[model samples]
Target: MDIDTESTATSLDENTENFCDNPTRDTIAEGLMGLIKPTVDQLDERVRATRLSQVELRQCIEGLSEELKRISEDQKHSIDLEVYLKKLINAKQRVTVLSNILQSAQERLNRVHMSIDKETVKRKVLLNNTIEDPHSVVLSKNIGSSMSLQTPLYNLNDFPDVYEPSEDTHLFIDALEKDMKYIINSKPTLACEIGCGSGVLIAALAKILKSTCCYFCTDINPKACIATTRTAKMNKVPLECTRMDLTTNLKCKFDIVLFNPPYVLTEELEIFGCGLNRAFAGGLRGRSVTDRLLNNLNDILSDNGVCYLLLLKENNIGEIGEKMGEKGFKIKLVIQRKIPGEHLFVYKFSKA
Candidate 1:
């Protein structure tokens, strides 16, 4: 009975060894592969578009095909221990072969990735240029057309008594050119420049619009009117010269109005005083003449009117804006520039 029990125990041990060997190993290997496949498949997809040279990629694909063929052949002949042993050997070889191919694939994929990165940057630059073309083209064309107005020729003799093209005058014109787009959109019909000395300001605008609109000027001095008319004729712009004191006589509603007023602070007696003094005399902070027109400006301007007024820093622009605001007008502080003695500002006013 002892001998029989020993033999039975040996048989159980052999069966247990058989149960835990190759078949169990294959099951565990398949289970591990099942767990890793999703992540590996994802990585494969990410690199597939730019991995390996065409020739090398094809070779790798063929290698994988051969490996599948070899496995298929081994499965077909798996009717004996020799076949199973060969499959085990082949499986080890497959691991080594796949590892080598995958390493080669990684090296090639890195090179391809670098090339793609370079190409992508170049493509992005091209894309940006193409995108900007549509939006910028119209604006650039408009700017090109607007900027075509060169500085009009000024004869010192024609405007001898009137103020010459001084720094303030040049700055006023520059600011006008800067806001040309807004002025063009406003499309003023009856535009007037009060205190239009030598007609330089009106002529400049007339030339820009090619005399498509009627432009007029007002001055208290008859000699100024003569000088302005002569200056306008020289520039070949049709400008109506009116001898008046700050739009006091005329009740015409103007769409666009410009004034480079007498902004020098002086005593009350010097307000519109003698020869050149009349040109630039402002009593007590240069507000005398400017305030007079501004008080009744709403009636002078049309519904879609815009006024451009030049002032010095001492003129208390904030207070002026507040006063204008109370009279149903809003002010835009357009441009300010400082030179030798004075800080000049150009203010634009429109109905609120």
Candidate 2:
């Protein structure tokens, strides 16, 4: 019985020791797992939330990228529009310049056409007339009358640079014709024409007088000098033409002085140059060139000299007459005619 009781005690002791050791280890491991498992689950939840936030952030970035791309395209379109607008403006300027150029070309062409028409008319007149002499022709105011006046020989083509004879020229000739008897009675020794364009007036005077009286002409244009010589030779008249500014440096006084000055109002810049501008461009009320001649008239004229000046109404004829009166001169309106928009007049001035 004693041995049996001892064996039972030993076995019970071994069983208790094994049970305590194994069960304690298992309880400790289970407790550690329970605490760790909850912590790991919390960490896993936080990680999932972080991943969701990352996905939302990535979506937001993609949306912003789309917005930026749209903005970039819009900016690019605006730039293109600006470029097109600038090009359009440039094109408009170019078109304006071309238009002005075309207008100027048209004006020049019209002038050329008018010149050609004038030449044609002159040729037709010459052909129609039965001229006794090719160099000259007797012009009769009364048809079928033996009493006739001779005209200076002139070809329009010979004086291209000279101002063509217009109504003013004819009007001046008519005035001279009306006073031809008086002029012949005066028996002038010297006669001069200022701004003699075609030498028609002086040559006509020489023809009518048929005298050995000296004829002098002065012109600003050098071409006019050549034209005057040609006209005088063609008409068998003696004439001395000098390229000068209205009798500058001429020491002789004249009994008869004629001037057909530029009577068209124009810019000051257009006055006092070569070409047709010098013929027609009278600065400021068409008095620039005329005033200079008037200022020096008394010095250039003889005591009994007569000055026949052609003037437009725009030349302030009243003012010119008043100024001439102050200079001990009398003004007489020899002839006046109105044609188109202008009224032209020839005034004879003599010492009072």
Candidate 3:
């Protein structure tokens, strides 16, 4: 009885080992079956017509065949193992044929892609060839040319509706709103936005302060002014839009004045070409408008009023603070937000 029990346990262990060692034929067959559909699809589509190299596909098949053949012949195993080995050899051959088909399809696709890329490059070269450098702008002077616009100075193409608010703008607006609340709590009468575009900034101020104070939106570009006015009306905010070229057209002063000037530096003039639109062109060194505005900042800025000016890092508008000191006005940045890739300077100034 003891001998019989020991033999039974040994036999059970061998069976368990065989069961674990055996490969599942169904799993291998399923994997091979998955390749068949994709290969057949490629063949039916005549993907080889596009200049695919059949040589590469042949190489893949040869590799799989070599691997499968070695595994089948070199390994002397049980009948179950031998049967599945034969199936693997067949699947490997099928993979080789599929590789050839896929290679041909890719070669054709490659040719088509090359042709499209070449055409695109040609068109870009032609367009760039026609584009004149900024230095040549002085030579192409015509009185009524597109460059001759006065008040609506910026070309419509200069500013694009990005549809997304930039991180810098978000931070700047938040800071501005906070400062706006401080001012409104103290002297909330009339608020004016200079160089307002799309009405986003002013609309935010309106919503935050929630005051019936008259809001004035002004932009040098007629299109910007009109768009901002429409946005204000849509949002049910009582605001007035006027085409005021900050250099000339603006006449009145307000209790609170907001200026977000186009302060992109000279080094980045590639963005703004010869079209000196009121929205973006900052003159030869990118400080022309900023310099003029700072000089006359006291005019539009009320006697005992607050002014919030958003300036670029390049524009040394901090010099304005020194000038304000001479006029007995106290000016501070109040709230500042440094955006990655660019710097925005916001100052809150009041008469001393």
Candidate 4:
């Protein structure tokens, strides 16, 4: 046992050396493991956070996509509404235009109806009565009578602005011719013609009567007054012409009053000026100018005065006669003539 103790000590020394080397290696391995484990734990936490952020980003993108889809739908609806509103506005404008056109058409139709009714009445009257032709009557009387054939003294070129004598003028003169005997018998002291266009009617009256009665003529148109004066001068008739409005300035009453007036139906706006248009622009069924004259008849006429008024068939002669009757005046249809598309009449009014 004593001789083996050295060998045993050598074995123990070898065992201790081995144990020390192993502890050194184990300590280094444990330190490396500590550092590596902390780094690995931090990396794992970062990865988890990145995954959570990715999930949130995906949710936010889907929400934005849904919002965009709703906005697109809303914009489409707004565009549709705008288009519908424009169409409605256009339709309203078209309706307004059509209403105006319809109103104009209705007015025209009413005028036509009136004309047709008038023509029908005239045709019936012609069938019932042996109405003499006015032109033939005038010609026959002229041929047999000693009275000279009266014509317009003023030439058309003399007063271009004055209303030229037309068929109406001839009709008026013919009517006067038919009533010549009555007029001569009445012995008018003062004769006046309202709205004397070319002084033809007054001039003829002066020539027919051949009496020394005062003859006066009035016209709103200054050119007409001048033409009237010129016509009287040319015809060697003693005529006094005045530029006045329908006996407005005259104080003396007339024994006889003559008015041709503007007997064509027209709008009031067309009768504004004292031009040639005023000669024929009778407003509202051709009675605007005539009604004024009728209302003022009592004031301007003498006790035994006679008013000769020219009127169209459309003027409603029955209504006019009634109105005159109410004014204490008797009305007589002295003469009537039917021309193409129109009927003309001369009404004689005198105090009852």
Better of 1 and 3 by TM-score: 1
- The candidate, 2 or 4, that scores higher on TM-score is 2
Per-residue lDDT of candidate 1, residues 101-150 (tens digit): 34534654585798699869867776787798845532233433647555
State the TM-score for model 1. 0.57
What is the lDDT for 293 in model 4?
A: 92
- The 10-residue segment of model 1 with minimum total lDDT is 135-144
Screening candidate 3 with a backbone cut-off below 3 angstroms (N, C-alpha, C), the clashing residue pairs are 50-108, 52-107, 52-108, 153-277, 154-277, 154-278
> TM-score, each model?
0.57, 0.60, 0.49, 0.59
Model 2: per-residue lDDT, tens digit, 3-65? 999999999999989987897789999999998999999999999999999999999999999
Better of 1 and 4 by TM-score: 4
**For each candidate, what is the lDDT?**
0.77, 0.80, 0.62, 0.80
- Candidate 3, 1-352: lDDT as tens digits: 9999999999999998887776786577778989898988888677665335576777889999999998898676645775567455434433433444355346545857987898688667656656745334233244236421111111223235311123334555756655754766766567888777667667777765556577887766666776676667766677888876663665667777777665554323333422223344344345666666667777877787787776665566666667778977788876675543455677787877
**Candidate order by decreasing TM-score:** 2, 4, 1, 3
Q: Which residue segments of model 1 deviate by more than 4 Å?
A: 1-149
Across 1-352, the per-residue lDDT of candidate 4 in tens digits comes to 8769989999999998998779778899899999899999999999999999999999999999999999999888745575567445434433433443355346545857987998788676655553555333222334336744455466546666677776567678887888888888889989999999889899888877776579999999999998888888888888889998999999999988999988766656767799877887776567888999999999989999999999988778789888889989989888887754457898899998
Candidate number with the higher lDDT (2 or 3): 2
Give the RMSD in angstroms, all C-alphas superposed, for model 2: 16.2
